[model samples]
Structures are given as structure tokens and as C-alpha cells.
Target chain A: MFAFFLSSGLFLGWSLGANDASNVFGTAVGSRMVKFRTAAIVCSVFVILGAVISGSGASHTLGKLGSVNAIAGAFMVAFAAAMSVYLMTLARYPVSTSQAIVGAIIGWNLFTGSRIDTNSLTKIVLTWVACPILSAVFAMIIYKLVALYIKFMKIHMFKLDSMTRYGLFFAGALGSYSLGANNIANVMGVFVPVSPFSSISFYGLFTLTSAQQLFLIGSLAIAVGVFTYSKRVMLTVGTGIFQLSPVAAFVCVVAHSIVLLLFASQGLERFLISHNIPPIPLVPVSSSQAIVGAVIGIGLLKGGRGIQWKTVAGITSGWIVTPIIAALISFISLFFLQNVFQQKTYRPVGYLITIDAAQRIRDGGVSEEKFKGLQGREFPTAVKFSNALSEYTELTREERDLIVLSAQMDEMEITRSGITGLDTNWITPEQIAALELLEGRVFDHQWQLDEALAEVSPYWRFREDDDKYNRDLRQKLSYIYRFFRYG
Target chain B: MSKGILRKQIGIEKQIDEFLDLISESGLIFKAGIGAYLNGKTDDFLRKIEQITDAEHRGDSLRRTLEERLYIQTLIPESRGDVLELLENLDSLLDQFKGAIWQFEIERPEIGPEFHEDFKEVVKYAVESVESIILSSRAFFKNIAAVADHMHKVSYWETESDKVSSNLQRAIFRRKDLSMSHRLQLRDFARQVDNIADVAEDVADRLAIYVIKRSL
Candidate 1:
């Protein structure tokens, strides 16, 4: 049963990757600061570290669900949770895998007429309400602080670029770490109870160090999410909500992380309550929703004109339906399967699995199988591995006419010596595919001389006297030489 | 075929209209006149350039009393080579007007059977060029290019001022009583002044290019 919950945690980890990875570095990638690949690689390293170190608390919470009949029942619950979150992610709504998993186990517990912890459910629900509002308030304060610093320094040109780039890189790394630390348990905790032989503490001297090992799982899952369908979500977030400036993007991510960490720490929540400060609700709130709410705060400050209402409505509507659907599916699916399917389950012709691959080499030779009863997955349906390769360059015909844009990106990497981007790095395989796909295909040879001379400054920044008004000047000049004849 | 022909006709008519309007805006021409006179060639041209130097101070005050104000510039079209040509003419016009003050050029108009006749010759070219331009233009239109060819006659006369100076200097030297320093000073007076017509030729060339480029 404990092993069942662990598998469910792994599924949730995948969904978490899809939903929250975008929140970390989406702006930077969309703004062309960093490639999605580099961000994912960084995210993979740090998120795993974060999960190994900090994932245990959330994993333990998910594993504590008491309704499973055997280790397989635990796996069933985790599977239902994973499926629920992935479906929501595919629809482009970033539902919290944390919330979905929690809701799943709760609904699963109730359907079997097992003991449901109403107290825990209430605490989790309160977090759902408080997290977004707190994140927005924090972002507003951060924005005001950044604005004040700029006004005080009267900064411009070179100083602004150098300092902001370094600071943004550091922030991206930190955000990735915090996300991994906070989000990893959404995939790993349930396995703790079922695996007596594999039972290792998630924290401390364990190989993954508590929730941090979950980081690898979460990172891969989220990478798939980012690489596969993040373009629409990124567009909706970056260009739609207040047309994010770099400072605004930074503030949104920072505030979102602060809120995620608040919920992640029981010690912190307890400390806050012991004082006059309000307690953080125990439920796992989404890093995506927290970030979006903060973005909206920024947009509102910028004014209604910049906020695209249609997109916001679409995003908000998804958050509303995702968990309810997950819960219904888990309840109906888990309940019917446990009662009806258990009796008629086919017994496998047990086969021996390679033991060395499953164990470390020792003086005593290949160690005995760490745990047996390795059952094969069987259901009314087969699990299809849905890994997709992204074609970012070929996605647009006119924008793909950005043949020049891709060339410029490669040149920027060459001259700048590495990828420049903003936000947290999480390794999601999908992001890797997106990055690899962009290689060698970007228009490299057509305008090398042009990039060197006239376009010395980054296209992202506007500093020229007329650039503020001359939005079409680039297009005009490109074709002007063709038409401007003296003969 | 019909549409193509109409489009070509429309283009040409528009070009001509633009040419006419450019040459004949009298208000602008008047500003050009003062700019020309004040900025005329010499070390003292500083006095004229400063007159319109402050962009804010230019208005009817500078325009109405131009003859009194040596500060008044006749160099309109402030950013172009046309100013250089106009200023060359103004220098000769100033000398002609000054010689009229002495009444010597009218009495004897020959070289220095008049010392001032060279100046008179250059100013004649200037006056003729301006008059020809006015006759070929109405309101803000120009047919001045065809008549503009005749101004070269005055230009040739302006060029003749050089021979007048050389002859006069030879005569000064022939006279036994004249001091060497006084004769040297006489030689210097008419040297730079004779190049006014060349300046006018330059202005005409530049203006023609400007017109052509504008499809005028």
C-alpha cells in the first residue's frame, strides 16, 4: 500500500513539473533571455537537490492516507492522482499536483468508507485561499521596492544591464532550488510506507536526501510539461498579463517561491501561529497559481489596459475544474476497481528479474533481490509513453521567417559565451528536446555582418532616441536599401 | 494601358507643381535675401551670420528693415548650398551699393576708369539672376530654370572683374609717384571679390540636384 502511494507521488511529481516549471523561467525563455534547455538543466540539478533535502514533509503527508488494502492499493491512489494532474496540464491549466494528489487520496479514502481526516482537509483548503493573495501582496511590495531602487539610483544603460543580468541569474537558481525543495514530495512520499527494504529516510544521509531525490523525478516530469505545451501558457503569462518587464517578472517569481516555501515548512507555519502571525494552511497550493496571482497584481498596477481579460478568464476557469475532475475520477475509478477487479485479477507466471541491476556489487556477490513481488502493470487500457519532440523553430511560418531571429540567438550565445536568461532552471526532458531542436536550424549565415554592425545592442532593449516611436523602423530599413536607388 | 498613361501624367504634373512652389515663395525668398547680404564673403561676415544666429529672434523685425540692418541675411534655404551662392552675390551687391554712395561707378563704369566697376559688374549679375527668377515665377510657381540660363551672361561680366583689377594694378605701378605699399593694398582689394559668380554657379548646381531628387 505504501509503495502504491509512492508511485502516485511519482505521477504527481510529473504533473508538478508540467505545471510549475514554467513559473520559474517562463518569462526569461519567452523574452529570449535564456533557452528553455539551459533552464531545464539547471532546474534538474537544483530541484533534485531541493527535493532530496526537503521533499519528505509533503511526501509524508500524502503517504499518511489510510484506505489502501495492499501496496497495490497505494499504487492505485498515486496513479489516479498522476492521471488527474496530467489531464489538467494537457489542457494548459497549471493545476497543482500537490492539491490534486491530496484531493485524490481524500476522495479515495472516502469512497472506500475509510477514515477521512476533515481537520487536514480544512487546513489544506485554507492554504488554497491564503497562498495566492499573500503572493500578490508580497509581489506588490517587491515591485515597489525595485521601483524605489531605480528612482534612487537613477540607473540607465550599461550599469542597468550588467547588474540586472547577474542578479537575475542568481534569482533563477534560487527559485529553482526553492521550487524543488517545496514541490518534490508531490511525487515521492507515498513510497516511504510501502517499501520496507527500500525504506530510506528522504532527509539526512539518504542517497536522495529526503524529498530532494524526488527532484529528479519532478524535474523530468515538469520538463516534459514545459517542452510540450508551454508555449501557449508562456504566451498567456508573459505577453498577456501586464506585458511583464524584467523587474515585474522577477518579483512575481520571488513572491511565488516565498509562498510555496511558507506552505512547505510545518515548522515555519507553527512558528507563525505561536506568535500573532497567521498560520500557513497545510494544503499544498500550486506554485503556478501563486505566481499568476502575483503577475495579475503587477498587471493591475500597470492598469487594466495591459491585462488581457480573455486570457485571464481562461486560466482562472481551469484552476476551478481541475481538482474536482481529479477527485471524481479517483473516487469512481479507485472504488469500482478495488471492489470489482480484485477477485478476477489474473495471476502472473512469476519470472525472475535481474538482481545485479537492482543492487550494488558487494564482496558477497550480487545481493539478493531487495524486494520481490514485482508485478506488471495491467488494466482495461495500456499506458502509452507520450513523449513528444518540440519544433520551436518550425512552429511559425511568418515567425519562422524569424529565420533571422534564430540566427541572432545563436550569435548571442557565441558572443555572450553562454545562454543569458532569467529565472529558475528545472531539467524537464521536453525542454531539452526544445533546445536541441533549435540547434543548427536558426538562420546562421544570412546576416552575420548586419548583426555585427548596425544591431550591436540587444533587440530586447530600446535605447535609441527614435526607437520609442519607430516600432517599424527595423522592417522599413531592411527593405529600404532594396528600393532606394540613385540610378 | 489607359491607367498607366494617366498615372504617368499625374506624376509629371505633380512634379512640376512642386518645382514651381519651391522657387517662388516670396516670403522665404525675402528671408534668403537678408541671409545672403549679411553672410556675404569677407572677415566681417561674422556680423551678418550672428544676426539670424538666435533661432528665436527671427521674425518680421529682421525682415521689414533689412536694408538698414546689415544684420539682415538674404541667405534663405538655411541648410543648403544655395546660401553660399546667394552670399557671394550679396558681397558684390554691398560693394555696388557702396560705390553708388560714392557716385563714381555710374560716372565712369569702366574698370577703374573706375576702381569700383568690378564691384558693379558682380552686382549686375546678382540683380539679373534675381530678376530672371522673379519673371519666370508667380506666387509659388517656377519656370525659372529655362530663364536661369541667361544669368551666365552676368556671370561672365562678373568674371571680367578680374581683368579690370589686373589692368588697374599695372597702371598704378606705371605711375612713378605711387608708393609700393599703396599699390600692394590696391592689388588686394579686388582679388577675393571677383569670385562671386563662381559661388552663384555652385548654388545653381546644388538646387538642380535637390529638385531632381524630389521628383520636381
Candidate 2:
């Protein structure tokens, strides 16, 4: 049953690999600087590693946007998104999995009557607009620097050709890695809420959670897609768009990779937040947009003469239309899945107003006066409860969900000592040492706590596991160290 | 048929155009050498011929480098033989310029005042013919449609050079005041000068055929 449900996510992963993977190595392979076989092999290996390691950060933000609570809902949403992308691909349009998945999630949110976190949605949309612009700026700067360096050094023709080839290979690898890290959320983010597998520990050295396992499987599907379907797409991008010099190709790939890394790197976000700088929103960005932006950047730098503005406008229209189509498809599909298939598309849960819920909402900085008339009121969904409560007091979707989750919980005593007494079997010695060092420090968010601990002991930071160990430790320590939740 | 490979082939063709430019530069130097000789500046003529020799050497090295690159890169496998043949023929045109200029520098043939204008006219026609061949060669790479016009000019200039050379040779031999050896020597110099136009016409003919093959 789980396997059947997971196939849709894998399908989406495959299509993502088929389409977006070309943006990474298309120019290199198309220009014949690197062979198609070599590019595919390198892209597959790095994409898998990236997906398994850093894929979770962007998905966490998607989860905040809307948690598709049922496995059936997740499957249908993924199917809808995949179908839209596949249909767009067949029509020879540029497909953005990011926009498709976001639209699908919104469809799910609307159908399940979940309150959409407007802040997170706004951030995602803003990044969509910013991703290509940022890539263009980065490409222009990098292209100029590389051109100046080549000019200053007066490199030989053959030597410059060899250097460009090497640079392309390196950039292609980084681009592949960034693609997997940022876009994996589009493939497996819906499944994360209803992940079927349990945490499996191997030899007490490492553990694989259900979400990571799902990501690994999706990444494999993506790798297969790259090996099989990406060749033609790569050739088109390499030669069909414009004539890209080897150096221009490298700059474009590098610029795209940097944009993906910026949006996907939780460590970078946390580093910024800790230094009193606003963090970049962790969102699944479109690799297609980034690459196009980079290409346009290089084109504009060369006086903008040869750029196919008509094609660019066409692609932009596709980007705008894809998400809306996916959303409509997901909504209609969910309706059919619920009515014809008789599947549980959403869990039927009700939230009961309790003292604990009211206190938590108050603690969240919502006014208690807003809850005056809603005492003991039973609501069918968190969205319904929050919709009523929002009339008097402004409440975000995340805070509303938190309040509803607390309201649904049975009364239980949670003491600081009791949390400390919980088993720390999975905690490493380095984490324990860092936790001790941070015994006196205060953190505004759970990630800040982990970042502070990571600063004290670098071993507390695991790059290969998506910071899972720190998250687990933070979850365990949250009982003793509670923080106010607000937008 | 692959666009990727086709684009790369265009890059190699561009390099070939640059190589033709170097050949054209050598032709111009050859013309300058003849002009200096006609002006009775023996030292200036030798110096101009030396510069023509340098241009020939540079053209030879550039042609070799281009051939090596084409062979190594295999940028245009199907047209490789035709392109190499065309380059070899074009290199021969430069060789004619170098050979004719060196002959004049070494022989230092004395010319009568009456035949000087005719000799200079032969040199002008020959140089113009080579210049037309260079334009046709460039058009072969850039604009195939323009190649025919330039090739026609090449043939017209080559014919003009032949007429001028024959008239000059007739005038030199008809001079009873000159020694037979001197007459033969002067005729040989005029024939050598006319040979440049013949070589350029041959290259232009080959280039026309190559362009037709490419367009086909």
C-alpha cells in the first residue's frame, strides 16, 4: 500500500530529473565540451548525494505551508503535479516543478480546509521572482570576473579551452548538487507529513528517518530520469537556445548553482539569523528559471543582440500557467479520489477548545479577550477554529495549527526535569558536550540553539544527514527550553 | 546534422577566413615590392620583398596551425579534405607572390623608361586579381551569395594581367637596342609577375567549386 502511494512522488521525481537536470549539464554536453555519458553519470551521483544530505531544509518550509495529513492526499497531490509537468513537457514547454508542487500543495490546503500560511507562501512567491534576477546578477558578475581574469592572464588558446572544460565539469557537478538539494522538496515534500517508514538505526552509527528514506528513493528515480530522458533536453538547451561559449556556459551553471544553494542551505540561513541578519527563505526554487536568468545575464552583457526574447517570453508564460493548471488538476483529482475511489484524502479530526489551548494561544501573543466567546467550542478543523478566532485577533496559520494541535492533545504534565530524564540514546558525545556549553545561553528559535551548539563543537554539525541529529537533540531539549512562537 | 557539431564547424571556418586574410596581406606586400622596383628604389624594393617573405612565413605557420587544429579537433570531418585542399591551393597563391618578389629582388632587372608603365600595369592587374580572390574566399566563408561576384572580378583581372604581360613582353623583345639576354630576362620578370594572377585565378576557381559543394 505504501509502495503504491509512493509511486506518484517517484514519478514527480523522475520528471524533475528529466527536465531540470538538463539545465545543469545541457550546455556542457551540447557544446561537446563534456560527453553526454560523463555528464549524466556525474549529475546522477551528485544529485543523489545532495538529495539524501541536504534535501530536507526546503521541504520543512513546504510542510509549514500546508501539511498534507493523509498518505492518499499526498499521492494524489504528487500525481497532479507530475501530470502537469509531464503534460507541459510533452507540449515542449519549460516546466517548473517548484511552481507545480506549490500549486498542488495549495490545492490540498484548500480541499482539506487548512489555513495556508500566507507569510510562507509570500516568501516562496517572492523567491520565485527573485531567483532568476539573482542568478542574472551573479552570472553577470562571475562572467565579467572570469573574462577579466582570462584577459589579464593572456592564457593560450588550447590552455584556455582545457581550463573551460574543467571549469564546466566542476560547475556541472555543483549545479547537479544544488538541483537535488533545492528541488527534492517538490518531489517528496507532500509525503513528508504522512511518511510511512519508521526511523531505522544501523550499527548505532547513523539513523535513517522515513523522510530521508523517501528522499533517497525519489533521488534514485531522478537519477534514472537523468540517465534516460535528459539527453535530448540537454542538447536543445545547449544548441537550440543560443550559441554559448564555453566560458559563458560555465558562468551560467555556476550562477544557477549558487542561487539554489542560497535558497536551500539551512546552515547559511541559520548563520545569518545568528549574526542578526535576516535569513533567506528556504524554498524550492526553479532551476529552469535560474539557468535562463544566467543565460540572459551573459546575453545582456554581450549587448543583448542575440537573445531570443520571444522564447524567453514564452517560457515565462509557461511558468505562470503551469502552477495554475497543476492546482486545478490537483483539486479536481482530489475530489475524484475522495468520491470515486472512496479514499481518505484528509483525516477527519476535530479541535476542542481547552484551557491548555487558550493558554498556549495567549502565550503565542494572541489576546485572551479574542477567546472569550469561544470557550468549550468544538471546531471540525484547525482552519475553522482559526477562521473564527481571527475575527478579533490576528493569527497566522502556523500559530493556529500549533494551537489546534495543543487543543487536540490530552492533558499531560510536561516538566523540565521529566524532559531531561528522557533517554538520550541517539545523542552523540559531541552534542552532549555542546549542550553543556550552551547551558546558560538563550535562543529565539530551535535552529538557533543547534547553531549555537554547532559553533561550540563543530562535530555537532553533520553535513551528510541534513542536520537530523541536531534536530533530534533539539526536539528532546525543547521541553526544558520553551520559546515563544510568533510570526 | 547535429547543430552542436555544425556550430563548431562554423568556428573552424572563421579561422580559415582569418588565414585567408594573412594570405591577402602577403599579396599586398608583393604589390608594394613591385611598385618600389618600378620606382628605381632598389633598396626599398628589397626591403618590401623582405616584408613579403615575412608575411609568407607567417601565413605558412598559421596554415599549419589551422590544419593541425582541424585534424585534431575533427571539427568538420566531411569537409576536411576539401577545406585542406582549398588551404593548400591558397597557400600556393602566397608562394607565387613570394617567389616572384624574390626573383625580382635577386635579378635586379633593368627596365627601359618606355616599358615601365606597362610593367607597373601588369603588377597592378595581378595584385588586383589576388585581391579579388581574397574577397571571394572571404565571401565563401561569410556570404556565399557574394562569392560569384568576386570570382567574376578575379577572372576579369586575371585576363587583364595576361593582356598586359603579353604586350610588355612584346615591347621588350621588339627592343633591338637591348641585348638578347637582357630582353629574355625582362620578359621572364614580366611573366613571373603575370603568374601571380594565374595562381590567384586557380585558387578562386577551386574556391567557387568548394562553395558550391558546401551550399549543396
Candidate 3:
């Protein structure tokens, strides 16, 4: 049972790395303000710091809501949470692992006949629901006020800008720690159901509580998530929000923190829910979505016309569909893997052959009659033609065209050689006869080469229709290819 | 002077003053552009003004002045295309100045209905630079560098303005309100304003460059 829970945690960690890491540095990475490597480092370090410092909050909620901590119970909770999260990720959705963990715990507790803490669950759910909306509002409200102040005090906008750059850098660093502290639940939620810190430790601390170990392990997992899979998510999140003003960013932080704290509370539902309070489920929500929502809300405040509907729809859809799709995919993949293991049969994958192999026929690469006839004509032999293909690849597009052009010249050389009224002073009779004989064979060899290329790639068909000089190129090639019906 | 010459001289003086007024006014507009930039306003007036530096508008303006004035001479006259070039450079400088202003607006655009003191020092110098040109026309080399001195003052203000712009950008991005785009445009706006001031200094430099070359 302990092994099951541990393995589940590792699986959850992989999924969390894939989906949740983006939450930490998605905006920075998306905008290319920080490279992937830099973002990863900052996220990992700060997450570790946050987890080490303040990671105990979620640990209490996950572990202590009932009488005794059982390893079997913890294992069950971890498996359910991991399964839920893993299912969500493969579908390219950004579901909250924290929410999934919380839900799974409740499900397990309910099944085990344990009393559910509706009030705490309500607070958690409300936070999930409110997180994105509140983040957006915070960004909007603070953005408007602070931006207004900065604009009015134009005396030192430039100076203030330098200050902002430094400040944001500071915030980014701070945010990392917050992520470690706040998001550890996504990592260590299951550990709560088992023995309270019996097997976990920190540094050389004696009898470290379960909460403390969660702080360390959760931070470590988050760091891994940040380093591994944060970029893709960050890009999705960053572009989801309209280009933000400094004020908007400030507001978003305030909103996210407040909302997160609201959910983090033990008695949030009874404390905040009014008679007409909006119904919100207990779940962990996304901060990125909250900020994005806030940005859109501001735009909507201006009017629907001001809001970019497409961007809004795209983001909302991503929010809605990500989890379900991930769930579906995970279900299917797991099913397939299970069935495949049971079947014990794997199909072998097929082989490829080359032109060189075709040329190696004992019957001869070409017929003697055709080969001799081609020799009498202008075409070069197979060996020479093969060399041209290798040489052509080395040339640029323009040089390749020049090679095609030389094919026409080879024909001209034959025609010029056979010119009955030509002056013999510039050309000799023997050379003329040789040129005449070589022309047909050379031209035919070039044709055969063209046919071969057409079989493999069909270069002309691959050309983009929008190419400006394509018409001209086609016209020039009209005569040469006319015999082969290229026109 | 005939009434026509008197009217023309008055016209030149008025136009020169108006141009200077526009420079100052545009500087404010430039500030607004900065505000807009910082505030994350994509549609900035300053950014539009910066686009004026393009060949079409300036080129057309240059053409008009050439056609109106005695600019295309067979032999280089004592008074060559100096006025024509001067006006062209002035227009270019203003365009660049306007561009700089947009940088501020773009990077941190959230101007309220209040005045921006950051522009006061920079604007004074710019105004002085314009006044120097007008004064130079009236007194031509008589009070050398007196107007140039004011232009020198413009340069100092520009440097100060640079500090202000940099400060604003840093401050704006630091605030939680700014997005990635907001910070970028804010920085751009600040740098652009400094560039405008630099162009104003370039005007002064051109004046000096022209004199040194011609006088020698």
C-alpha cells in the first residue's frame, strides 16, 4: 500500500511537471523575457524556498481532517489524486492538481465513512472558483489606479521605469517562493492520509512533523515541474492575457493572493458565504486563468467591442476542455496499455529501398538497346546522372535552376553542332559530329533524371503558388519540358 | 521694407514661433504617448507622430519648401540650401522627438488630466533650441551660441529627461499592474523620448557642423 502511494506520487509528479510547472513562469517564458533554462532555475529554487518556508498550510488540511493517519488511507488518496491528474494532462488540459487531490481525498474519506468537513471544503472550492476571476479584478483595479498615478506624476516616469524593472525582477523571485509554499499541496496532499511525518525528515531535524516533510518534498516536486514542463504552459498563459500594463500585473498578484488565502482558510464558507452567495465548488483553481480573466474583464468594462472575443474564447475553451480531454486520454491510454500487456503481441514496423538497389539488377540497370541508343543520343549514362543529383543538393535554389538551364544548353550545343551553314573556323567536323551524337543522349539522360526526381519529390508541384517568379520559370521550362508534357 | 516683405518676415517669424510651440506642445503629447505606453495603451498618438519621420511626409515637406524657395541653384550660393536643409532637419528632429515621446507613452501610458513635470526641463531646452534657430535667423552669428547655448541647455535637459524616462519604466514594470508587453513598450517609450532630445541636440550639432565646414 505504501509503495502504491509512493508510485502514484511519482506519477503525479511527472504529470505535475508536465502541466503545472507552466503556472510558475509561464508569463515570463511566454514573452521570452526569460529563457527556458533561466525560468527553470528560478522556479526550482524559489519553489524550494516557498515549500521549505510555508508549505505546511495544505499539509494540515489533507492529513488532519479525521482521527488517525493510516498509510493505507494515504496510499488510496494518492492513487486517486494521481489518476485524476494524470488523466487531465494527456488531454492537453490545465486542470488543478491541488483540486483533484482535494476531491480525491473527500471521495476516499466519504467511502471510508469519515465525516466530511463541508465548511473547509466549501472554502477550498470557493477559492478555486474565485481565483481566476479575482485575479483579473485585482489586476484591473490596481492597474487603473497605479497607472493613473504614474501617468499624472510624469516628472519621473523614466526614473520610475528603472524602479519597476527592478521591482518586477524582485516579484518574480518572490513569486517563486510563494509557488513553493502555496502549491505544495499538489505534490504532498496524499502523504497527509498516512503516518504523520514518520518516514520523512528535513536536514538533521529530529522527529520532523508530516507537514515539514511535505514542505520539502512538495517543493522538490514543484521544482522538478518548473524545470521540466513550465515553458509550454507559460506560453499558453502569457499570450492568453492581453499585453498587460504594470498596474494590471500588480492588481493580479493582490487578487490571486487574497483569493488563495480565502480558500486556504479553515472556515471560509461560513465566514464569507452570504444568503445570496454564488455557488462555487471546492477545488484548487489556476492563477494564470484568474489574471487572464481580469484582463478580459477590464476590456469588457470598456465594452464587448474592446474585448477580443477570439482570444477570450480560446482561453476559456482551454480552461474548460483541458481537464476533460486529459481525463479521456488518460482513460484510453491506460486501457490500451492494460489490454496490450494482456495480449502479449506487438506488430513489427516495415523497410525502405534505394535507387542504387534498383540499379543493381543483374539484368542490367538499363537495356543495352536503350543504353546504346541513349549513348548515340545526347543523354549521359546513369553514373553521371547520379553524380548530378548529389551535386545539385549542394547548390542553392538559384544554382539548381542554373543546372536546369544547362540542360537546355546541352540541346542547343547539339543543334549548333548540326548547323549545316556553320563556319568551320570556330568548330571542327569531328567535334561537331561528337556534339550532335551526345546531344540527344545528354538531353534524354537529363529527362530521365527529371522523371526520377518527379517520382521521388515532384519539385515543381511543391513550389508555393505565391512565388513571384514561378510563372516566369514555368515559361522558360515550357520548351524543354514540352516533349515530356510539363507545361 | 515693402508691406509684402514686412508681411513675409512676420509670416516667417510667426511660422518659426508656431513650429517651436508645436515642438513644446508635441513634447507634451510625447509625454502623453509615454503615459499611454506605460499604461499599456497600444494606440498611442506619439507612435503615430514618430511615423511622420518617414520619407513621404518629410520628403513632401522638403519638396514644398524647395519649390517655394530658391533652393536648387546651378552654383552653390553664399546662402545655399541652408534654410531648406535647416527646415528639413528641424522637421526631422521634431519627428524623432515625437518618436521618443511615443516610447514613453508606449512603455507606461496612463496619463491622467494632470501635467507631467518630467517634460518641463526637457521642453524648456527644446523650446530654447527652437528659439536659438529663430534668433540665429534674425541675428545670424551675431549672438553666436547664445541660441546655441540654449540648445546646449536642451542637451542637458535631455540627459535629465533620460533619467526620468528610465525611472518611470523601472517603476512601471515593478508595479504589479504591468504585463510583459506593457514593460517592453514602456522602456521603448522612455528610450524614444531620450532619442528625441538627442535629435534636438543633433539639430544643434548640424548647425555647428554646417558652420565649421562652410566657414573653413
Give model 1's TM-score versus the native structure.
0.45
Q: Write the per-residue lDDT of candidate 1 for residues B1-216, one digit (tens) a residue.
A: 334433443443343333333322321332343234323433233333333232213322222233222122211111123323333333333333233222322232123334444444434444444333333221112232343454444445444544664565676567556677655654543443343334444444444554342121
- Candidate 2 or 1, higher lDDT: 2
Identify the candidate with maximal lDDT: 2
Model 1: what is its DockQ? 0.01
Q: Candidate 2 at residue A230, lDDT?
A: 82
Q: Write the per-residue lDDT of candidate 3 for residues A8-36, one digit (tens) a residue.
A: 56566556655665554554454433456
* Model 1 misplaced stretches (Cα beyond 4 Å): A1-9, A56-69, A120-128, A196-232, A261-264, A269-285, A343-487, B1-216
Ranking of predictions according to lDDT: 2, 3, 1
> Which candidate achieves the best DockQ against the true structure?
2
lDDT per model, in order? 0.47, 0.73, 0.48
The residue-by-residue lDDT of candidate 1 on A420-460, one tens digit each, is: 22111322344333333333332222133233323443332
- Judge candidate 3 against the unseen true structure and give its global Cα lDDT, from 0 to 1: 0.48
Error of 1 at B73 (Å): 53
lDDT of 2: 0.73
Chain A TM-score, each candidate: 0.60, 0.73, 0.51
| Candidate 3: stretches off by over 4 Å | A1-4, A21-24, A31-36, A57-94, A102-131, A155-158, A192-211, A245-247, A262-289, A301-308, A314-487, B1-216
Error of 1 at A136 (Å): 2.1
